[model samples]
Structures are given as C-alpha cells and as structure tokens.
Target chain A: MLLKIPLAWLQLARQKIRFIVALAGIAFVVILMFMQLGFQDALYESATQVHQKLKGDLFIISSQYKSLTSQQSFPRSRLYQVLGFEGVESVSPLYVQFSKFKNPQNGEKNPIYVLGIDPAFPAFDIPEVTQNLDVLKFPNRVLFDQASRPEFGPVVENFHHNEPVSVEIFPYNGTVGYQVNVGGLFTLGPSFGVDGNLIVNYATILRIFQDRTPEKIDIGLVTLQPGTDVKRMQAALTEILPNDVKVFTRRDYINFEKDYWSVRTPIGFVFSLMVFMGFVVGVVVVYQILYSNISNHLMEYATLKAMGFKNKYLLDVVFQQALLLAVLGYIPGLIISYGLYDVASNATQLPVIMSPNKLLAVLISATLMCFTSGFFSIGKLRSADPADIF
Target chain B: MNEKTIVHIKNLNHYFGGKSLRSQVLSDINLEIKAGEVIIMTGPSGSGKSTLLTLIGGLRSVQEGSLKVLGWELYGASDEKLVQVRRHIGFIFQSHNLLEFLTARQNVQMALELHNEPDRIAKVKAEEMLHAVKLGNRINYYPSDLSGGQKQRVAIARALVSQPKLVLADEPTAALDSKSGRDVVDLMQQLAKEQGCAILMVTHDNRILDVADRTIYMEDGRLFKEVVL
Candidate 1:
C-alpha cells in the first residue's frame, strides 16, 4: 500500500502544468501563513527582550503595571526597600521611557524606547545588556540599534564628523534638549513587538530629564543570592511592597510580556485572522483543483471501480495527490518566506526570526490543510458508481 | 452439455421507466450457461440483449427472479459480496474502457493488481496475455495511441489476465472494421474453447455468428429463438 503512494505521486507529476499550479497555490498560502506567524513571533520578542535579557530571580514593578512592556511607574526609592528585605541579594532600578528621536541630518522622526540602567550590574544578571555596557556608559552617549540606524537620522554622519547633535527628548514629565554624542551600535533578536530601542547610561538619561522628579522609576530587577528560594522571596516582596508596586518571578515577567502582546494588543488578532484566511483559501484552492481533476477523470474512476478497486483505494489516490502537491509547493514557499522575511525586516525595521520550530509548524499545518481538502471530497469519490462505466 | 451450469437465471424480469409507463426489457428470462460454452447473444438495436447481458453479469439487478453465478445467488447479494464475485468474472466493454493513463500492458496488469497478485508476476502474466491476443509488440502504447482493433485486443487481454471462469463482452467488435471485427470474434471464440471459460457476448454484428457454438436471438424484451451455428 505504501509503495503505491509513490506511484500515485509520479502520476501527479506527469500532469506538469496542473500539478505546478496547484503546488504554487498551496505554497503561496503557506508562505503567507508563515509570514503571519513570523510577525507574531517578532512582536512577542520585541516586547520581552529587555525583560528576558535581565537575568533576575524576580522583577519588581508598579502594582498598576499589568505587564513589563507597559508604562507603569514605581518610585525609584522602592529599590532601597526591596534591598532591605530578607534573602535580597541586590536590587537594581531600571528606567524605561519612550521618546521621539529626530535624525539630526535627515530630520526624519521615529519613536524609540530609551532603556537606562547602571553599568555595574552583575554580568549574569543582564548578560546581553553587559555586552553594550561600555558603549552605553560613555557620558552623553547612547547606543542605538544598528538595525535602526536609518530611523535614528544619520547618527553615523554625526559620529564621523565628530560633532554633537542637539536632539530634543520628551520624558513625559517634561521635554528637554541636549547635545548628545553617538556611541557605538548594538543589535538584539527581533521578537514579535518591541523593536527600535536605544540604550544609554543612567547619568545621560538623568541629565536629559533633569527637571523630572527622581521618585518615579519605570521598574526594578531583583536578584537573589545562591541557595535562596525565588518564589519565597517574591512572596515576601509582594507583602512588603506598597500597594502601588508589584513583584514577579523572572519567568512570570516574561510570560506577562508575552501575554500582553498576544492578548492585549491587536497585533496578535490581526495576524491570527490572516492565518485563518490563508488556511481557508488554501483549502478552497486545493479542494477545487482535486475535485476538478476527479470530475475530469470520472470515467477512469468508474472503470477502476468496475475493475473491483475498492473505494478506499480511490481515496488513497486522492489523498496522495493532495499531500504531494503540498510538499512540492511547501519547499518553494518556505524559501520565499525566508526571503520575504529578510526584505520586510530591512524595510520595516522589524526583526523577523525563523526558527526550526516555526518551520516545522508551517509544514505540519500545510500537510493538514491539504489533507483536510482531500477529505472534503471523499463523498464524491464514494458516490462514484462503477455502473456508470457501462 | 453435461448440465454443469456456470450461470443460472430463472424467471428474471427487468423494467425501465417510471411506474405509470413502465416498459419491460427482459421478461421470464430463464438461462443456464455451461462451462466452456461460447454463447453468442444476437439481437437488433433496442432488443434488450445488452440489458440481458448486464443482468447475467451481475451489473444489473434481477428484479423478479433469481440469478445464480458460479453457485452464488446474486439477486439479493450484498453489494460488497457482488464485487467479490465480479473480481472472478471478467467484463469487456465496447469502448475498450482502458484507462487512458495506463499503457497497453498496464491496462491488463491493473486487473491482476486488483486481484492482489504480486506485481512482478502480474506484469509477466499480463505480457503473456497480450501476446496471446497477438498484441505483444504494442505493450507500451497507450489506448489513444492504438487503433480500434489494437484497443479491443488490449481490452481482451485485460479481461483474460485474471483467468476468470466467465467472460462477458458487450459489443467487443462494434467499433472495428470488418476484418478486425472478425479477428476479435474468432479470438474470443478460440480463447473460450482453449481456456474452458464460459463466454457470453452481446453483439449486433451478424457476420461472426458462424463461430458461436450456440446463438440466442432476442427481440421485444424476450428470447425469440435459439440457433445452433
């Protein structure tokens, strides 16, 4: 029975134009579906990169903050109280602010999230952040993403000329202008949402927002010494922290960020709708192609039935053809998707990463899509009577 | 005839059209075909010979009587079991009914494949059957690539490949020229005699009736006469 599958596939290949067209249609749908999935993944990655890179046992934020990606503010002084709790090894205050940046040369403006942190944190606590610590610590300097350089308005031009650019920064509380120096560049993995970020040291941010009260900070990252139970420490912090503050495990923080983008944001809904549409279109195209093929060969099918070939055999042939079309189209579809992802990432300043798991998911979904289309036509095959051949 | 009946039809009647204007196609059809007998069924157009042949072949339901093929009753047999019976009996069509996708050799091999035979053996046997029908050189040719005579020969080869106990042919030579039609009828008669497989053919061609061991003439939905040629 399995040997016949290849034979059926060969027969499908013999019909060159129809097979190619059907395969291309399925591949087109699959590529569209993969892009949707990739976009969704990029959004999630963007929203959680900072939280994920911060290797803390627990995270302390304002209780009003539903997720790490949100703009809830806590008192900067709360970091001291968290450090005073039992089992607390160290607590770091982190500043997160969204600012509008203008390209000093092009004058093109874009929104960037400025993450301000101390350079003295343990390397293990913020592994990826430590890599850019030196560049970020330079006075009046900011580390912009290499991928986002174009949107940041000719930072390279300003750096080459050894000139400082007076850029205005709005810290929400007040707006201030500064002659900021461009430091080195850095890059991070593209998650589904949070992209286009700038990293700078605490002093530069403080100077830029000099008039803002230091009482309010965006969030706090807490690390426990070895042999400390992180869950217990989180519980203790939650009880001791003020009602306006919240504490979470590191894993919980990542989940919160993921849930925020996937559930709270429209990005997830839009992509999901697109994926569903792709699935429906794929099924419709494949089903029509197969149904038309069967109808064209109705006499042949009847003769086979008259020759005593069972209905099951007829179904096997239909399903084999569907699967063959799916696989044939999927190869090119995957290639096209990778190329599209690259082009879209460069054009939109979004990070789109394709992983083995994502590819596997796409392939499985494609196979299922083809199979379902084939299954939908089983009724027509079963109703095919051998007597019709007479 | 030693009274060893391969096909038994008793009081079989078939009708067409709705109840208000029903027309009988075959009424009180009592037939007993013995093994190795070449039975030629001859009739004019619309004489219901093809309908009778279909009934005997289990391709049509016996509405008012019993039809027994190889000792198994077919009148009320389950559809699945009837298919099992059909696998042991070969049917050849007027149009050759050869799958256009398959080559001449594959057309015959398909029948053997349906019977669950080993592929290598089925292929070899199909080649032998094609050779028997004098179509050995056209094994790789598709039906569309073959002439009318060659296509009919391939159909015969397919029907004979399974070594069925009975062979039913409907207008096996209808589309062929005179010489080709004679050749097909003669070959069918010869094979029937040599293989000892009972043959029932429904044909309108009267020129080849001389070769039939027995001939039955049908008209107006009933057996009109039996002629021993």
Candidate 2:
C-alpha cells in the first residue's frame, strides 16, 4: 500500500522549461477544442430556445418545416382538433416570421424575428411575455426581447425607461410598414441564424402580414393533464392530423431543431472537424515531448532495466508522465475556455454555455490524447538494452 | 571468505551476427567468480573481455555453452529469469549514465523502486548510500549540476544502494582523471568489502590493478593467464 516516489513526475520536472512548453501546447489544443465545441453547442442550443422554453408538454409543426430558421404554417383548425384527444389540457396557436424594423429615432433598419401568439393562452414560460398579454392583445403593440442583440435599436431601453419608442414593421414591403409601440421586455436570446426578436398578438401580426389569415399558425403548443403520457397523446394526434402537419413532444421538437442544425447544416461539420484537428495536433505535440524524453534517457532506462526493473514499470513511468501532462494542461485549458465562452457570448449574443457533459467529454478526450501519445513514445524503451549501455 | 560461486561460465561461445563462427565475439570462455571477491578482467580492445563480462552479468545470451549466475542457468534462459538475476546485480558504466533530470538521491532511489521499496525507506537508503559514497552534500544536486567525478559517485550510489549481490563495472574509471579514477576505484573496493558483495570489473586501467583480489588476462576471446594481486 505504500506509495513510491513518482520518478515519472520527477523526470518531467527535471526539464522545467520542456515541461512548461508541453503543458502549454496541450492547453492550447484543449482551448481550441473548447471553442469549437462551444460554437457547435451554440448552433443547437440557441436555435431551439423557444421550443425548449414553451410552457407546453407537446407541440405541432408544419411537416414542411426544414428548421427553426426555416418555418412554415399549418391550419390553426388542426391545433383545435388535438383538444378532442383524452388528457389534453389546452392548445395555443403561435405564428412566427422574420421582418425588418425601422428605428423611430434614426430610421436604421434591423432584421428581427417576430412571434405572434393568442393573447388568451400563455404558451411561453417568459414572465414578461405572459404578464403583458393585455398589451399584445391591443393592436400594434409588441414585446421586445431584452436579451436580443443590440442592433435592434433602443426599443427595450425605451420601453423600460418610459421614453417614446416606435417601430415600422415591414411584412415584405416598405410601403406596408405598420408602425408599432414597444409594450414590454422579455428574455428570449438570439441564435446564429437570427438576431433580435419581438412577441405580439396574433391579430397584430395578421394586420402586418395582410395576405396571411388567422387560420394559419406556425406552432401549436399543447399542454397535457398531470401525469399524462405524452407519447400516447402524440400518437393520437399524429393519427388524427393530416400528412401536412407533424405532432411532437416538446423534447422531440427540440431534438428536431438539434438534428437539423447538427446534420443538415455545414456549421456543425466545420466545428466538429476543427475539434478533431485540435485533438490530432495535441497528440502529436505530446508525442514529441514524450519521445524526446525517452530518447534522451535511453541509457538510463537500460540501466534501470539492468537493475531488474520490469518493462511494465518503465512503461508505467512514461504513462504517468503523460497523465501528469494531461491534468496539468487541462486546468489552464478549462479556466481559459470559460473566459472565452463569456467573451464569445457577449460579442455574438449567442448562448455559448459550458455544459457539464461537454466538459466531461473534453476532459476524457484530453486524457486519452496524452495516454495515446505515451503509448507511441515507449518504442524507445525496447532499445534500452543494458548491454548497450557499456 | 564464503567462496560460493556467484558467476560460472564454461565454453561460453557467443556470436555477434548470423550464427556463424566468423561473427563470434567471445570464443571458448571459461571463468568463475566467488562471493565477496573482486575479479578484474584485463585485455586489449577487441579481445572480448567486455563481451565476457556482459555474459557473466546475464546481459548476453550464452550460445553453445553452459553459463550460470546466481544459481540461474543463463544459457538459453528466459528474459524473465535474466531480469530476476539482474535485480540482484548492480551495474556501473564508463559514462556514469545518471538520469540528467533527477537529483543524486532521486537517481539512487530509482534503483530501489525496482524492488518495490516504500518511498520513505527508499529515500532514507538512497541518502545513506550517497553519504557513503561521499556525496552527502550533493544529494539534492541534479546530474547536470554535479562534476564528472561526482556523477560517477552518484552512479555508484545507485548501483550499491540496493545491496545488490554482485557489482559489474565496465571501464567505470575510464572517463575520470587519474586522481578521480583512483578515488572511484578505492570507493568501489571499500563499498564491495563493507557490503560483502562480489565485484566483476572489465578494465584496461593498469594503475588500479592493486585494488583487485585477482586479475585475469584475456586475449583473442580466451582467458590467457591469471595473476593474484
């Protein structure tokens, strides 16, 4: 049970500058992987914030919907049909589109995503959106997302400070721009695909999109009774609904968006490829360090072998050195990546978060990278013949 | 003296390449070493004294001969058995070969790690051996920080720290000055006597001949004569 002095650690520490350089290289690779993974996470997480936060157990979307960014509308009568199913609590119709907003003060134009919902039904968990339902029910009143990117003008600041705020909404034409008032502030954040957003009543949105009717809806939010099985309800709705519409639980709806971003989009592939490149670069750098260390001490290793040290013991020392490099390097990588995530979030307004699962994943990968490098370097040990030392 | 045989070699013919007699490095070698004794093999370059020394140390496989070290028949012996014998033997080389990264004490402690000694005891014994080799003040000094003579002393400490039953020195004093060389050989002799361990040295340095219990002359891969000093 007694512990031996770790010669591997001592050997690495002997060349302090070399050890520092090795750790620095590893840290750089870890940070690269963190940034790549962070971008990948943002692509999925930020794109599906609405789907994940909707105060409903199940949802219905147009089967023509390609992604959250690419949306289509189905008949609102289809949502009402779900009410006939057992265990159904309520159904809320939501309409979504992207339009340009003309700043009242400067006349600068900014593209913003718009969500319109029935004022009678609370479909989102956002308190600001629910509390000001009366304001959205009135014509030409919309709640601006405070967390939306700053280029959307001072609507949120003006709404909070009691200043005059007005925006001209363009439902595809400049002449048909409907001037509207900022009613309140909500907290839905922006994704890579879109920046800035506002929530309004379904009637208000109908007024802006003059060609669109109230019968067409984007998302059909369905609340279930307590302890109801969502899968059974989803199956019932799928059977009842026509092929033009699709029924999904909230989880599946979120996953749908995730799959779209991760599979159908090139952003996911680019980020994953960069992460893989970083792993390869890290392994090579660590391999060079361990290989050089072994080369320099070939004779010493042979001497140890002559002293009755098993090859396993010699290999253990090298592996221990690798683990030390991994752990020592990972600390700085994790610390620096956290700071980078914050910087990225502030600069881009995307939800670049450090999830526990991703952190665990990167840690395991970093260790494996170093361990594999250790394996590659031990080929030098085979040449450590004690007879050659003479 | 106990006079128990620690090394026995008979007709130990070894070839360097291709199993042919043309590549034979050592030819018809016959030798024996006893407990707590010093045996120095002196010969010219290419006379095969070093090869015979390596064979006796269980370092080379004995081809077409009978060879035994520490009761293990090393002629066609398994690497594991050779390794078991190596653990009981200490080796000193011409270059000292101290690990440049570790301090003198750490280098010596590395030897005990093979034997699975606890860290605390390894450190204590390593320090004790360094002090015995007159390197007490240099225990914390890295090999790069030590003088050539001091590095060799550290090597000696590493070799003797485990109380190995046999010490093999191959031109150990070749890299030192005359004064340092004499001092190194004197230290090896004193430690081998104090520890009651056998010493097998392959050297061409005639100045240190007085320290050996017996000097054997090898010529053309064969023992030519023996001289008691």
Candidate 3:
C-alpha cells in the first residue's frame, strides 16, 4: 500500500527548459524516421497502382520485364495461348509505352504512360475506365488519369464542364504529334518514372506508333472462371508458355513490381539508409539527455543508496523516464508527419498516406530507441558508491 | 560484547586507491556504543573521523578486522549483508541532500518508505516526526525554500523517522551558525533520547560538545583519547 513517488517524472519536470529541449531533440529524429518510412512506402504504392487495379487473376509479361516503367514487350501470340487452359475465361493484350503528351494550352510536352487495350474487353477494374469503354472505341480517343500531375493541362476540369479537351500524343522519339481527345478520366496516380497516364484502344497505339507491330504487346491480362484455382492455372501456364514470356499470379505481379523499385533501385536503398541514420541519431540524443540528467542527480541517487534503496530501484526510475520520453516525443512527431504527408502527396501526386501499421511501427521503434539509450546511460549510476559521494 | 551494545568495532582498518597507489585511511580503530548513548568524535581534518563513521554505518565495505552493528558482523560482508545493515541505521550528512523536487514531508517519508510502511501510516509517522522537530508548519515546503537550519532539522526528522537503532551523523551542522548549530544538536539529542537510539556524531564544532555523553578525539588515523562527560 506504500505510495511510490514518480521520481522519474519529477526529476524531468524540475528542469523545464532542459526537458523541453530533450523532447524537441527526440521529436526531430522521430519526424525524420516517419518521413523516410512514409516516402519509402509511397514509392511502392504508387509504382504498383496500375498492377493493383488490373481486373485479372493472372498476368503474363516478357521474360525481360523489369518493371512497369520499363518498356518490355513479348509476342502477342503468347497471350492467345492462355485462353486454351481449362480454367481460363478470356485474355486481353495490354500495350504499355512511355509517350510524349503535348499540353494543348502551352504546347509543352512531358512523358506520359499509355496503356492500350482492346475496347471490347475490360482491361482495368477502375470504374471510370470500365464505364467509358465505348468512348475509346472511337478513333483517337483516350481516358486521362484524373490524379495526373497538374502539368498535364486542365484536361479533367475542362472535360467536367462539358468542354472538349484535346491533346496531341507522340511516340517517345517521334517528330509528328497525333491529335487525341481526352475522352474521360480515371484515378491512376503518377509514379516516380511517369507523371501522367492515358488509356487508349489497342489499334490506336499501333496507329500512333507506326513502328509498333500487331504481334507485339507489353502485358497480358488473364481472367479466370469463378472458383477456379489461380495458382494451378499459373503453374500450368508457366509450364506451356514459351521461354520468351513469364506467368505470374496477380498478387505476385504486384509484388514483383514493388520489388523492382524497393530492391533494384537506389531510391529505395537511400530511404532505408536514412531511416537507420535517424534511429542512430535518436539513440545518441536520448543518451546525452539521460546521461547528463543522471550526472546532475548523482548526489541524490547516492543518498538514496545510503537510505537502503537497491540499485534495482534507481534503475527502474531511469527506465521509466525513458518510456515517458518515447511516448511524449512520439505524439508531436506523428502530428507533424500527418501534415507533411498531405503536403508531399499533393506536391508530388504520389500516394503518401498514414496507415495504422506505420503509426504502430514508429511507436515501437521510438520505444526501442529510448530503451537502448537508457541501458547505456545507467553504467554511471550503477557504479556510484554512497561512500565516495558523502 | 554487551547485549545493549549497538555498534562494536575492534582493530578495524580501511584503505583507498588501487593496488599500485594504495593509501591507508584508518588503522587500528576500536570503538563501542551502547543503546541510548550519545557519542561525539572530534579531530583535525583528515584525521579519519568521517572514515570511521562511514565504516560503522555500512557506507563502505569493511576491508579488515571485525566490525559489528546491531549484532551483524561486517568484515568481508556480502553486498546484501551490507545493505541489510544499512537499512537498520540512519545516516545524516553535512548537507541535507534532500531531493529538491520533493517537499519536506515527502523527504522524511523516504526513510519510512524503505521499511515498506503503508502510505497512510508512513504519512502519519512522517508528519509526527516533523512536528517533533517543530517544523509542523513547513512540512509542505521544498528544501530550496527552507533555511539552512530548517533543512538540517528536516534531515534530522528523516534520519530518526524509522526509530533506527543507531544514527550516524557526519558534520551535520558544519554550515550552520553557532545558535542554529546548538539548536540542531539539541534537537538530535532530544530525539535520540526519546527513541532510545544511540548517536555517533562526527564534528569539529566545540559549541555543541557538551551534549555528548562521551567525547572521543583522534589524530593520524588513530583513536588517541576518550573523555567521559
């Protein structure tokens, strides 16, 4: 029934300026960790936006396929082969290429990703694209991504107001521009490599790029009958498909694209390294604060020892202070990170969101970081002899 | 040793520094104190008076010879044994060493807290002890707000709150004026008599020497003379 005093809290509260400065230092590193983790996740999310939105159970890509941003094409005949499987329902050939999009208002051109599919079949699960498939059937008509960067002109705003927005599209290295009408709008946001997206008919891609052949395609989407085993079909397809193409389940397809950016690219490596550096910096900051605080109160601690209190009791006090700092410092850091997510997302047109998992992840990391510091700084208190201090 | 002897020491020795630079701080020290006895130890600086007090209070491990407090031998004692001995003894230093963040009542309660007394009982005992020291009105004041004499009184309340068997004080009034110094020792003597506990005070102040039942003087790490009042 003995009432234990919160010695850790009282010690920290006694020095208002020092406590505030310590919290500020911890918050700075927490903010650094949150932002690095945020952007790293956003990179994977944005890069796989199209892959996640595709309405298919299985997919086929060229064996040389590295990522969606890369232009890897295989023979269209490989896509037609998927239809012969027993669980197969239908297959659609998707042509993806980076093309120049000329802003009609300013006549400036920027690189845009173009996904060309047959208008007869649903190539994407997006409501805007599925609902407006008939519009793409018309020659020189394409659906522009509503989430595309503002640099793609005011296509969505003008189109929503019943005004026609026409922009010219050209092959990556072509000189002449092909006039295309912005038929509708969808929500595939930009990635690091491509700033805008366009959904067009398969024949339009061939017409726009004269060098493109009918037999070549970038990706092949395969839908299965209900209750069909996708894994079985994927295995059977991989067994029969020529070595020029690779088969993948939709889940693996998305992960494959994510792995390309997270493992094979320098941006992902840099973000991870930055997060580790933030952790090290946080440990150092907390260590310095706790070390100096213990040093200042060495006499009181020795007095406690002389009063028959065990070293365990004093250690408990120090660890309690560490936990307090972790939780208190994490709150402000999370709030600021939320604000920054909005700013970064709006500015870059990428998906930078705060998930519950990320929040929990950072909390655990902050607690661990502080505990590491607390463990290191207690050596002085442990060796403090009441005899010497008196 | 008599059953009433609270602290008994014989041929005790202590040293400082590592093996290469070892220096003896106390040698051939012999002392004894009975229950309810007030003993004063005075000597020139560096005469090892404080060192002997520290050894008797279990602040430092006994390096050689037999030292016993409340019937527990301390020579080559384990840390746990030293800690056990320490809990039964009260220590008062020259400085009050009050936790600045805590009030006077809480600081006094820290001693009783070591015995795991219930919060309500500890509070009652701490307040009663403070009242005995005539600081009832300032129980809620922090150490920083108290005067030097008042701080020393608070330290007295803290050391005696548990009614420990032996009280060890090292230069308890070194920073106080003559009047306050006399008042502090008088307060300690009154409280120790009331609790029937022995007091071993190490001091250089001669004004308060009359309060001790016997005075012991030391020079060159040896107990040279004993004067019974």
Candidate 4:
C-alpha cells in the first residue's frame, strides 16, 4: 500500500483546476504561518544578539531595566561589590544609550544605538570590532555598523575607499553635540527597536554626554575563574548587591530579553496570534475542500461502502489526501517564505535567519493542521450510507 | 440452512427513522433464492421492492425476523459481520454507479481489489470480464466517455467479476431505452447462467420478464402473486 498510490490521488488529480485551487489555498495558509513564525523568531534572535556576543559569565543591570533594548544605568559601585567576592576574575562596565545620529548626507538626526566600553579588552565578540579595538583607544573614534540602514550615510563605502568619514552625535538634544570619527566598520545589524550601532570608548561616553556622572554605568559584565560554579557566584552577588541592581548569568540574560519581547511586547504577541490564526484559516480551508470533495463523490463512497469497504478504508483515503496536501502545499509555502524572509531581513536589518527547528515546527504544524481538517470532515463521510445508494 | 440455498429469509421487517416516528418500509417478507435461480421482483414504485432487495443484500440492518445469507444469521448482526456477508454478494445499482474517474477496466478491477489478488491478475481478470461483456475495445474509456448501454455493461462486468453467489440488482436497466434495456437484461441472464449465481432483480420493465426463471409481483410492500414464465 505504501508503494502504490491510492485511488484518492487519482480522484483528486482528475479535477486539475479544482486540485490546483485547493493546493493554492492550503499553501496560502502555510505561508501565513511561516511568515508569522519567522518574524517571531527574528524578534528573539536579533533582540538577543548583544547578550549572545558579550564576553561574560555574569551580568549586572539596573533593577528597572526591562530588556537590553531599554537599558537603565546603575551605580558603578555595585560592580565593585562583586569584585570583592572570592573567585571573581574580572568585571568590566558597558555604557549604552539611544543617541541620535546626524546623517552626514542630509543632516537629519535619526536614532542610533551607541555602546561605550573600556579600551582594555573586547566587550563584544564581533570580528571587525575586535580586530579594530586599538583605534578606540584614541578619543572620538568609533566603529560603524556596516549592516546599518542606509540612512546612516555611506560610512562603509567611504571606509573601504580609504576616505575619512566623520559622523556627528546628538547625545541628549543639541546640534552637533559631539563629532565622532568613523575609523572602521562592524556588523551588529539591528533589533526590533533600534537601527544602526556605534561603538566608542568609555571616555567618549562622558565627553559626549557632559551632564552624566562617571559614578554610574549601564551594565557590568563579570567573569569567573576556571572551574568556579556560576550559580555560587550569582548567589554571592545577589546577597551583596543592593536592591537597585539585579544580577543574571549570560544565558539568563539572553532568555530575559527573549521573554521581554515575546510576552511583554505587543508585536511579539501579535506575531504569535497571527500564527494561530493561520492555523485556523488552514483548518477551515482544508475542511471545506475535503468536505466538498466527499460530497461530490458521495455516491461513489456509498457504493464502496455497499461493497463491504469499512470506515477505515474511507478514512485512510481522506487522510492520505490530507498528507499529500500538507507536503505539496508546504513546499511552495516554505519556498515563498524564504524569499519573504530575505526581503524582510533586508528591509528591517534584523538577523532573520531560518533555523532548522523553526522549519521542522512549521512542517509538523502543517501536518497537524491538515489532519485536524481531515478529522473534522469525516462527519460528512458518515452521510455516505450504503442503504441510501439503493 | 440448506447448502444449495444462497439466500433464506422469513418474516423480515424494515423501518425508517427513530422509534417515535417510525414507518415500516418492508413488512413480513419471506423469500428463498437458490443457486443459479433468476427471480425478478416486479412491483410499482414505492412497493418496497428496492427495500427488500437491499435487506437481502445486507445493505440495511434487519429490524425483525430471521434472515440468513451464506449460512450466517443477520439478526442483530454486527456491522463487521454484515460487511463479511456483503463480500459474497454483488450489487448492481439503477444509475450504473461506475466511478467516473476510473476506466471501464479499472471499474471492473475495483471488485477484485477486495479479493486480495495480485495487481496483474486483477487487471487480467478485469480485462477478461470487460471482454465478456463485449466491451473489449472500450476497456480504457472512462464512464463519462461511455454511452448509456456501455456504462451498464461495465457495471455488470464489475458485479460478476467476483463470482458472487447472489447478485442483487435494483433496476439495473431503468435508464436505458427499450432496445438497450432488453439487451442489458438478456446479457445479464446469459452471464448469470454462465456464472451459476442466483440473481434477485427488482424491475418494472415487463419487456424482459421472459429472461427470469420465475417472476413475483409485489403490491404495497407484500408479495401478492407468483408466476413461472
């Protein structure tokens, strides 16, 4: 039976236009589900890129901080408190702020995220940023995000041509508040909130924002010695630090960002809801198709029933039809979604890579969706009575 | 149960709908059909002729009395039991319900699928059966491409391909013209004799009464008279 195609396939394929229409409808729902799931995945992936790249075993952030996208500053003294603990290897402070960038082309100020770190070691694992760490030691020099939206001017093109491209920053609210030199290009892309990124030295943070005090910092990246348990270090920091700051390991911090977006943000909830709606749409469309198909062939089915074919045989045929539609429709849906993912990633500058887990999940979801429809349409098959065929 | 008897029935009753609004469709039907016997049940429309045929064919459950086919009692029988009983009986419908999606040969081949024969053997048997009905050249034509008489021949081929002991036909030639109808019944008579299967057919076509070994008349759901032609 597995090797031979069932008569259901022949019956469905006999009507070319109707079969194509059904396939198109199923594929439409599949694509809807893929895009929604893709956007939700992209939201989590891009939002947690910084946490994944940061070199740290533990992190300290302000208790009021909801996510990395909305960073708040805590007193720098809290970072020193963790250093007093035994087995604490090193602690480095990271400064973050949503500063405005003066697009050198048209002199328009657009919001760009800025990261300020000490010049001693790499704060991020990005290759371009790590290789060009020496230049950050010079004041007013910053690394430009090459994947930034085009509104940030041609800093990438200018740097490749060996031209000196300069960018002005508006730290709080002033025209040309600080002039930062774009010495090199890096790629951090963007998150759901902020577009474009600029990396600078800790000293440049104070120079750009003169009103800020040096006693506070946005994040404290902490490391532990070899073979030290991270849980013990986390417990020690929690007991020693004040209520104004919170401590988390690298994994927890990444998960916190994901949770904040997935549960707390409306866009995340909307994407998830859209995926569910796509499932509903698929079930409805497929149920109508299978039900109508059964209706059209009611007499034939009754005749089969009259010939001693059991309910299982009829069900197998409908289920086989569902499986075929799931596989066939899913292929085109996934192909189209791949194109949409590229277009969306380029348009939003978010890291929207299609992971294997997401693809497998959608495939399983498609199968289940069609299966549910098949089950629902079996009620119509009940109407096929051998008694009525007489 | 007699070994030579293919179908035996006594005081059979049938109903329609739930108990509160029940209506009797067949009442106290008593019939016995033997091997290679051709019994034509002639009656007006709504005289329970089709209902009785379906009951004997196990298309419907017996509400009362004893009905046995192939030595298996059908009173309070499970659906599984009824399905097994149906395997030994072939049915021909009024509309010649050949699946339009299948060719004439495939339509006949569908009967052999249930017998668990090899695919090649089923094809061979199906082609042989279609050729027996003089449809050799139209073996690959779908029912929609077939004419009225051609479709009925294909239906007959499908029903007899399995060599069922009892063939129950419900107005098998109702949709054909006079000449085609006569030709269809004559063909059925010839095939039933060759296969040695008892046939219980319900029809109002008086032109083909001579084909039956005996003819019974029904009025208002009762077997009123019997005549041997």
What TM-score does each of the candidates earn?
0.89, 0.95, 0.96, 0.97
lDDT (Cα, tens digit) per residue for candidate 2, span A67-92:
86787989999988888878999889
Candidate 3 C-alpha error for residue A323, in Å: 0.7
Q: What does candidate 2's lDDT look like per residue over B62-175, in tens digits? A: 788998888888988888888888888999999998888778898899888778787888899999999999999988998888988999999999999999878999999999
Residue B226 in candidate 3 has what lDDT? 97
- In order, the candidates keep a fraction of the true contacts of 0.25, 0.77, 0.58, 0.60
Candidate whose lDDT is highest = 3
Model 3, residue A39: C-alpha shift (Å): 1.7
Give the better candidate number (1 or 3) by DockQ.
Answer: 3
Off by over 4 Å in 2: A1-3, A173-175, B1-3, B19-22, B116-120
Question: Per-candidate TM-score, first chain only?
Answer: 0.88, 0.96, 0.97, 0.96
Ranking by TM-score: 4, 3, 2, 1
Q: Which ten residues in a row have the lowest lDDT in candidate 3 chain B?
A: B50-59
Which of the CAPRI classes, incorrect, acceptable, medium or high, describes model 4? Answer: medium
Q: Candidate 1 on A18-96: residue-level lDDT in tens?
A: 8888888999999998999988877777667677677578887887887654677878888898888778788877777
Better of 1 and 2 by DockQ: 2
Cα error, residue A280 of model 1, in Å, equals 2.2
- From the highest lDDT down, the ranking of the candidates is 3, 4, 2, 1
lDDT of 4 by residue, A1-390 (tens): 231325778878888888888889888988898788888888888888889889889999999999887878999999888888889899999998888998888988889998998989798988888899998999899998888888887778888999888888997576556888898888888878878888999889888888777788999999889889999889888888899998999888999999899889898889988999999999998888789889888998898888887778888999988989888889988899899889988888877777798789899999999999999999999889998878
Per-residue CA lDDT of model 3 for A177-279, tens digit only, reads 9999988889999988779899999898999999999799999999999999989888999999999999999789989988898899999899989999999
Output the worst ten-in-a-row residue range by lDDT, candidate 4 chain B.
Answer: B50-59
Tens-place lDDT per residue, model 1, B109-147, is 888876667778888999999999999899888788999
